[model samples]
Target: MHNIPIRNLSARLVDPFQREYYYLRLSITDVCNFRCNYCLPNGYQPHPERDKFLNVDEIRRVVRAFAAMGTEKVRLTGGEPTLRKDFVEIVENIADMENIHTLALTTNGYRMAKDVAAWRKAGITSINVSVDSLNSRQFHRITGEDKFDDVMRGIERAFDVGYQKIKINSVLMKDYNDGELAQFLAWIKHRPIQMRFIELMQTGEMDHFFQRHHLSGQLLADKLVQQGWQLQPKGRTDGPAKVFSHPDYQGEIGLIMPYEKHFCTSCNRLRVSAKGKLHLCLFGEEGTDIRDLLQSDNQQLLLQARLFAALQGKREHHYLHQGDSGVRTNLASIGG
Candidate 1:
């Protein structure tokens, strides 16, 4: 039995697992501009109505409700958040909220050059750009799009603005960009950003590409050290990433090892889909539609019930341990 007081959402303000989860990943849209081979298969079809996304007002209301229940950080993600017509409007609304300490975005960076200023004014100070490779051929091969130039322009422009802690998220593939890890490190050493090496989990469109070259985070780190890289433990976060850095290297490296091991015990985060479904775990195929409860007659009571339901819904660990591809959802559609 826990003695902590229940907040507005009937959230015990403490998870049963003993972790204080204060961050919420909100997927505002399921649409994306680029069709990364790993994210979606070749025959992938975009959502029919990308314009029919969750309105800014609804997003704010939900953010406020979650904040009341101890949500202090929020990240706006999508197939591409920049692709949203009112993406800036949504960020502005969340940033103005008194309770939210951080409001960030994860994008392919195709439109960062155009939206960095607006995003900064709207209350998003940090941004994560997904760049799979620096080589043009590899870039096109990975993203299946030729918008690499646009993405590069976005990165430069983002740094030009007040946006600091700019992070480059690279999903490592087995046979594809596995050998270019050193090139990635060399590039980041001179820049003012953090380069992240994410272990590709066997899931989504990449399921077919899983065994071709599944590299562990440890292997990547070992390679980094072999390249005359000096690293030290930086810190930890709710998500994946065992962070390290090189001496005098302005940027650091984050190694996200979600599938290699599980961190469910201290996990205290929940993700909300664009359509208002609350996910207890990323690999969860089923979710409690908190949208209905939030709009019900007795919202407060319903909210508490929803919280309890979400907690009870939390599986002890993700099914990845079964020797299967652990990633259950697309990273872009879901907030990474």
Candidate 2:
């Protein structure tokens, strides 16, 4: 069966990037469990605080509508996706939709110790766990919660729950965790996890880190090469990470340069934030608010208008222009 629901709209679906954006990211909540320095503002902007949020049933309807509009892959995200009360129910509901091909989630993994099996039972086959440091002290420094043991327990539980592939995401910042890149990479080697080294974007609370220290993906890949591991490049795809592999290892590693450049022009995905806002571009300041439409269950012309705006919002590329593209926010709010 065709993964997209575009049978009615395919003829009009002229992919500006030569392929339809097959991926959809649905942020179920903006609330996270960790107080990562790079994520929330000091102690002021806590995770439990509400800006605007969506109900589980409301999110299911939105995903169903997206499935009808030709989206096939859906990944649930959040400040921490697992924090939502009906997190597993949301996953199961989306998985039951025939149009969705892949269902995934990215999380901080601090809360998955006991719930991992339940998460798997909900039909999630893959997971990406965000771990910036393996060192306990440094880890606590970054997340403000020395729940390293908890995070590791989650990883173990993910494997026990039968998650096919697990990728570990490590954000590289100068002096902070950059010194531990090789350590982090080596830690995941031979394991069921792919190690991803992400460059710190000058967004969110990470602005403090960006000004204080810096590093790049190219540099990290080079470091791996020096350690006698062959960095084999994987061809680009709509998926987030720009993948690479180690010749002798079973996992992969990657870098996503959202600030330096975005995979936009060819961008095929759109984000429905937990707050019921449609963000076409991760860096796009404008979010088409569909909260009212979602609340009223209005599937009128406005729905199509929102889709049009989302498509029109797709730029040939992100504003990685040398000086001042003005994306100072961090990945926390965007659900990366």
Candidate maximizing lDDT:
1
Worst 10 residues of 1 by lDDT: 1-10
**Per-residue lDDT over 165-232 for candidate 1, one digit per residue giving the tens place of the 0 to 100 score:** 78889988876788886687678778877888887776655565766767788887787677556656
Candidate 2 Cα outliers beyond 4 Å, as residue runs:
1-19, 41-52, 204-206, 225-238, 259-262, 296-302, 321-328
**Candidate 1 ranges beyond 4 A from true positions:** 1-9, 43-52, 225-238, 294-301, 324-329
lDDT for every model?
0.72, 0.71
How well does candidate 2 match the true structure in TM-score terms?
0.87
- The TM-score obtained by model 1 is 0.88
* Candidate 2 lDDT score at position 287: 77
